[model samples]
Target: MNLPKKAEDAHAALAAAFNTGDVNTVMSMYDVSGFIVPEPGKPVSGAEKFEEAIKGILSIKGKMEIKTVYCLQTGDIAVGRSEWSITDGDEVKVSAKGIEVMIQQNDGSWKILIDHAFGAEASLVA
Candidate 1:
């Protein structure tokens, strides 16, 4: 699969890949040095660790959808926000907002540097 040419494209690609239930295709969106926040506060780095979390979701057999809220690009880096949801038949399985950070590679393809899957959740007051 080809990497995204724009920041918003990354979210679209990810949703499409997730819907396919192909872990390899979904994993290709991330940069080698990237890390993903699978949970609210727990960050997972490296391919092996993040792959497990992705697989868990794919196993749910739900269709994923993403709507880009906004994307700002500066130089070769970009940051985006999106609203996403997963659905099984007529029922919604999961719905959330996320933040994605991406960097454009030498080939001009954007790869995800940080994927905060539930980043938009409200934070607790201290």
Candidate 2:
């Protein structure tokens, strides 16, 4: 997997890898300590778990489109938000606005530390 040179490019890297349906490449974009919120309340960690979560999405067999909404960085850490969607031809498979926390590695490539897939959604009244 090719890591993004800038934090702003993380979403694009992920979208490209996801569009290719390569779980390993997608997983490679994450840091060893990273975790992902595949569901609003469920955070999955570990390579095996992350890979499983990614596999489920890949099964949708849609193309991923992600646009960076915002990104703030200081030192080696960055936080970003993005609006994303998956489409299979004319049908929308998934759509969401999310947040991601990333860290710049020693090599100056950014890796995802936390990916909250639904973080930008409006909270329900409970």
Candidate 3:
């Protein structure tokens, strides 16, 4: 599979990978040293942790939908905001907004550097 050249493509690939329940495919879009915050106040780093996080979400057995609302690229770094929804059959199991920071590699492909899936909600928690 080809890496994404744009931020939108990366998110689209992620949704496709999630729907397939392929953790490896999902992780491929991320930088090797990247990290994600799977929940409020919890940051998971490293390839092993990232793999574990993706596996946990895959276990939910739902279809994921991602919509990129905003993206701004500066030099080799891009910041994006997106909304995601996960549905199991007719029921929506999860719906949330997220912010992602992507870095363009030497090959001109983009990879996620920071994935804050909880977005601002994580910061507002008391």
lDDT of each: 0.85, 0.89, 0.84
TM-score of 1: 0.92
The deviation in Å at residue 112 for candidate 1 is 0.8
User: Which window of ten consecutive residues has the lowest lDDT sum in model 1?
Assistant: 117-126
Native-to-model Cα distance after best TM-score fit, residue 105 in candidate 3, in Å: 1.6
- Which runs of model 1 end up more than 4 angstroms from their true locations? 123-126
Candidate 1: tens digits of C-alpha lDDT, residues 12-122: 988888877888998888885888987677888888988987887788777899999999999999999988889988999888888899999999998889989889867
Candidate 2 lDDT over 1-126, as tens digits, reads 779999999999989989888878888888858889887788899888899888988898788999999999999999999999999899998898899999999999999999999899887111
Query: Using Cα atoms with residue i matched to residue i, what is each candidate's TM-score against the true structure?
Result: 0.92, 0.94, 0.91
The local lDDT score (0 to 100) that residue 71 gets in candidate 3 is 88
Residue 78 accuracy (lDDT) in model 1: 95
Q: What is the C-alpha RMSD of each candidate to the true structure, in Å?
A: 1.6, 1.5, 1.7
For residue 48, give model 2's deviation from the true position in Å: 1.2
Q: Model 2 compared with the native: what TM-score?
A: 0.94
Query: What is the Å distance of residue 14 in model 1 from its true position?
Result: 0.9
- lDDT, residue 99, candidate 1: 89
